[model samples]
Target: MSVLIKTVGFSLGLTLVFTGVANMLPQVEGDAPVDVKVDLSALTMDDFVAMGEDLFNNKGTCTLCHKPAPLGRAPDVQGTNMVAITTERLADERYQGKATDAASYILESMLEPSAYVVAGWGKKGSDDAESPMPAVDKPPIQLSDIEVDAIIAYLQAKDGNEVTVALPSPDAAAEVAKSDAAPGGAGAAPAPAASGEEGLAKYTCTACHALDSDDTLVGPGLGSVGARLSEGEIRQSIIDPNAVIAEGFPAAMPGDFAEKMTVRELEMIVKLLAEKKQ
Candidate 1:
């Protein structure tokens, strides 16, 4: 009986130690919640544009993926003339929304990013059928409706296009607030899954490259990156994106992925990407 008790105690100690070690390890996957609010009443078009520019650079995280010039990872916001294209998309057979003009079209893009993906940037395996862009109003980068409006205004004004949406009055803003506070009012959408391949989607990698095919989106299709680069090279590319920019691609990849990814998370992604081969 004494020997049996000692064995059980030892097993319990080992279990506790293993549990502690597991807890101490860094987490490689999970979703972080975001709670954001913004009020756009009583601001001028200039104010909206200014606020929009700030948000784009900082809060919106737009500059992380988008650039003024065409980068293989994402679209060039400036070079593409987003405002003008928004208006043009209205006549496109792929545009399924009721946006009659540029402002509404831009808003639709923000709210329903997958509705109309730009060519060469769609999800893989679908023949340019789906968009990889996350809804701006969704999690990980949740922007309120008014904030979205400001971004549109900024995109328009910066590109020398006409800003169509006027700022709301204080009374109108108050009414919007009331509606939001009411039952069944504005609420956050479901957060994206944060593990495995879904984790890649959560990070919006599909925005630029496909995982399973060689079809180039904005960046080189990562279908067979392992065949071309070593594991160390793959990790380096994520940590120091410009270290070895692939040929025929701009060195516009964001350099902050190292700060955003955990060591284990980096390993997972590298392993997945390495499996791709011609």
Candidate 2:
């Protein structure tokens, strides 16, 4: 009877030890979390506004298109009341978006940019009906929803207008990052374009320059640039943009394409932009 009691006590002790070990191990309830999965909810509006500024300049690449007027490929909000103009945009005969207010108009503009192309800023051949700007949620400049709202908030606050966008939540941030990261997310730039159209879209050239058409954009019409500048001159223009400002246009071409573009990308873009005269 004493042997039996000893054996039972030993078994119970082993079971307790195994239970303790299991408890000490890290407990993963489901799938592994993304490395960048972060709770953005705690970030204050002021912080997001500042973050928006940085993103607008860098990560979001908004400055690449939205510069001072008569210079930017897109409408330059500089010194312009984006909020006041938004109301006008909503009331325009051409306005087709579902937004009922300023904040939503800005957000919708970023998401479904084709919904209301600003006059004279549409893609070539779209008759001022289709914007050339890519949806900010897509590749090349995939600003997360929170980041987009931050930009709206910043823009609104910048113009002394009321910010109406809701703050981000932990789940929303985590989910967006996780989803966008799944398939070559915001961090990945597309490979060098294989064709002229691809190159044009990839580099956002059509935003400012008319490539195959006479449509007036922010930059000089490149439809016949080859009739003017040599191939080497075209290369120089891209790499050292500010060196030779085109007459009647602001020196607004981004000067950092030398750093941002790969050799293959540069070559393809140059090939497309510099068609030698026959």
Candidate 3:
């Protein structure tokens, strides 16, 4: 009896120690929880891009719902051109600092989708407007304002013409600081754009193209497309998709849908694609 009691005690202590050790090791794979410690202020463009990629691929888990468009919508990473969808609309001066860019708009769309309902895309027959992107502002997925800023910067860079971002000038920063102190200063992030141009990819574009920054899928990744095509070229590509087929890519983009899609929708989709950048 004495030997058996000693053996049990040893086993219990060893088990506790093993569990504690496992918890202490920095993020283990598979079963381990992620330990993100990104310092936004110190991050370079590369770092920001990496973090944005991480958010898109892993942590924020955007792929789960807003997948690339080709396969089909929802529950699949099919045809979504998220990069283009995010850029063109954010470029509008009206978006300044408030869903002003693709990243911010995506963040806003992620956190609050109901504020601006995308026409024809709102949840059918719902009481209040319902957004498809789930709310991720709670607990583990909670995003800090600075992190949100980094994400916006990253996406903007991805969509901008492969050029270095013009960092906010000191004067702009000072104005921002002043605004932060004012009433409702830089208040809660604005709701995402319900404008058809901004909302198209989220609703239908992804149904045919992938929207990721680093990879290709049903459709090619639109990383630096902006650098290669003019607005007119992009417009023509959309209205007459078969006119210029991207090498190694199928011209399988549904052309017969010209009748199904309005000219405005075609223009918006084309313009969005023209904005991709690495």
Candidate 4:
């Protein structure tokens, strides 16, 4: 009888231990830590307004494109100066059509700059005709944690006193960097070089153009380009686009100065393209 009792006790103890272990396991699926997933039911409007100011001016450098009207270098808040502009934009029928609130719209703008361009903002003939805003999510200028939170706070405050969706803090920025460096992350593997003649295969020139040499895609291609243009000509063609515009190619190819691209990278790419045989 004592042995039976001991066995039962041991089984109960093991079950409790397993239960404890299960409880200790980390949450595997859901929004990322940096991802703004928490409910902002407790925050206040004053908090967000302060945050927005920081983001607009120095934090995320949002003013660079929006060209604040008063400032001219940043986006101008037309309603009640900068403080009230957030709410005004939130109420504006145009932006609100798709976004749930001012805060969400602001956050989305930072995350996906290409999704919706403010009307009449983009270059006359460019793909982003609706908005000319440069993508802020790209490299070399990642936003800090405090900056994201400040921007989020500013937008939430504009909506007549509501819960401010506080973004993760600066400490979170380090985590973002680590995640990006991890395998398969955005900064993971360098792209493979693709031969232009093989047809645009997604990663290579295809990103900016179509496959056929003559067929117009985002940029012109190699049908007779190899035979006609010398290596120097091709290299010059890219570095100094205004130097020559192919018969049908648009003159708008953005030039990459030595300031933007290394000499080695430019030379290698130019050489590879120049060597392509018809």
Ranking by TM-score: 2, 1, 4, 3
Error of 1 at 163 (Å): 2.2
Q: TM-scores of all models?
A: 0.55, 0.62, 0.38, 0.39
Tens digits of per-residue lDDT, candidate 2, 192-224, equal 455666756656666567676544565777877
Alpha carbon lDDT of each predicted model: 0.65, 0.68, 0.47, 0.47
Clash count (model 3, backbone only): 24
- Which residue pairs show backbone clashes in model 2? none
RMSD for all candidates, in order, please: 10.2, 18.1, 21.0, 18.8
* Stretches > 4 Å off in candidate 2: 1-39, 124-126, 176-234, 242-252, 259-278
When summed lDDT is taken over every stretch of 10 residues in candidate 1, the lowest stretch is: 26-35
Q: lDDT score, residue 135, model 2?
A: 83
Instruction: Report the C-alpha lDDT of model 1 over 1-278, residue by residue, as the tens digit.
Output: 35435534543454455453233333322223232344645567898898788777766767767765444345777466776777667777877777778788778777886677777766555666766566777665667676787888888899888998777566667766776665424444223233547546555566466678776655677888899899878878877888899898767566755544444455567778877776
Give the candidate number with the greatest TM-score.
2
Better of 2 and 4 by TM-score: 2
